[model samples]
Target: MSLTSNIADGRKKKRRRMKSDSDISRPSPMQSHIDACVSFKDKQVAARVTSDAKMDEWFVVKVINFDEKTKKFEVLDEEAGDDEEGGVQKTYKLSASCIIPFPERNDPSGTQEFPAGRNVLAVYPETTALYKATVISTPRKRKSDSHVCKLTSNLLCAYLRGYLLEFDDDEEDGALPQRTVPFHKVVPLPEWHRQRDLCIKMRLNSEFGVLNM
Candidate 1:
């Protein structure tokens, strides 16, 4: 009777543990929706991921191609200089993580969802506006991988939402103008490519173009 009782207690404990595990297996509602959208879009991005699963700061992923018809985003690894000698080009496929909602108007709380977060209007004043940005990061092929392939502005934007501001270079000493254009812009992003000459170059339509950002 004693042995039987002990065995029954062990089974009860195992059942409790299994219940806990099942609870953890469920994904959040928002996360589940985001996953569905990305899976539908078939998009991807890249990032300089550390071995310990941390993202480096101020990196950008250049979007080489996008197919609106197919609703997919194509990404490529940005490289520096001419590799007259052969070198491995590192790139990843990614999809949008979330769906971007249409802009809202006349809300008591004015928050845009695109650029996202607070702009550093004045370090002294400390005023901000909120915005929302849909970000994309690549997933590792391995099922048990611990890290995402890229880091994105989604987290920062969420934290700083409703406090976005713009900085004036004229007022700032040694401040450079911000780039806002795609391909020509020098905005810091998740996949960064550094060149020794400080000249930014991109390949568009099988041709190389250089721009000073």
Candidate 2:
């Protein structure tokens, strides 16, 4: 083959290889959704009823079935009293975004643990933001491993139906309002501190600052 033709073929092959690599590195939409969806096996979860006008109350439920095609779950409301077989089980279909899984028992394999007074990044249900919070109460042994967290924000606390609306804050405070949240939603801030520091460092770097700007 001529030198010019050989060079062109090599370049085309390189482009095809790069394109395939990029395609393999990018996750499919369904895979991304599945990765973000909270696993709802045998554990109890809190789900917000979007159909309700207020959308403020969260119903604690157990997952009976998950429909992958619809991305919805068939849940049995635990708060509702039991009824006869097939009689008013209080079942509802909920989307993944509306469901929050309860925290599992502190196991040796996992690092997320809610000890009283410990600072944590809690998933604030009202705003769906992970904010700085303090563990006011730990989970009871018999009950679901849900922890009561006090948000550190100074924003006015509002109670609508059964949900507490609070702002996200990075500051420290002792007088913040408390709300109950699943233990799994409470992440230890220390584990993320290093990443935050690295981000700060990169933002302050001269080259990075100029590039980001």
lDDT for each of the candidates?
A: 0.34, 0.57
| Shift in Å, residue 58, candidate 1 | 5.1
Q: Candidate 2, residues 11-95: lDDT per residue as tens digits?
A: 9999999999999999999887665453565566656655763333555567877787888888886544446544455778888
RMSD of candidates 1 onward, in order: 18.2, 15.4
User: Residue-wise lDDT of candidate 1 within 28-132, one digit each (tens)?
Assistant: 786675555444332322323223323221123445554444544454444432476356554444444211221122231333222333231111121111111
Regions more than 4 Å wrong, model 1: 1-34, 37-48, 51-85, 92-173, 181-213
* lDDT at position 195, candidate 2: 70
Q: What does the lDDT come to for candidate 1? A: 0.34
> Which residue pairs in model 2 clash with each other?
103-184
Q: TM-score for each prediction?
A: 0.25, 0.44
State the weakest 10-residue window (summed lDDT) of model 1: 133-142
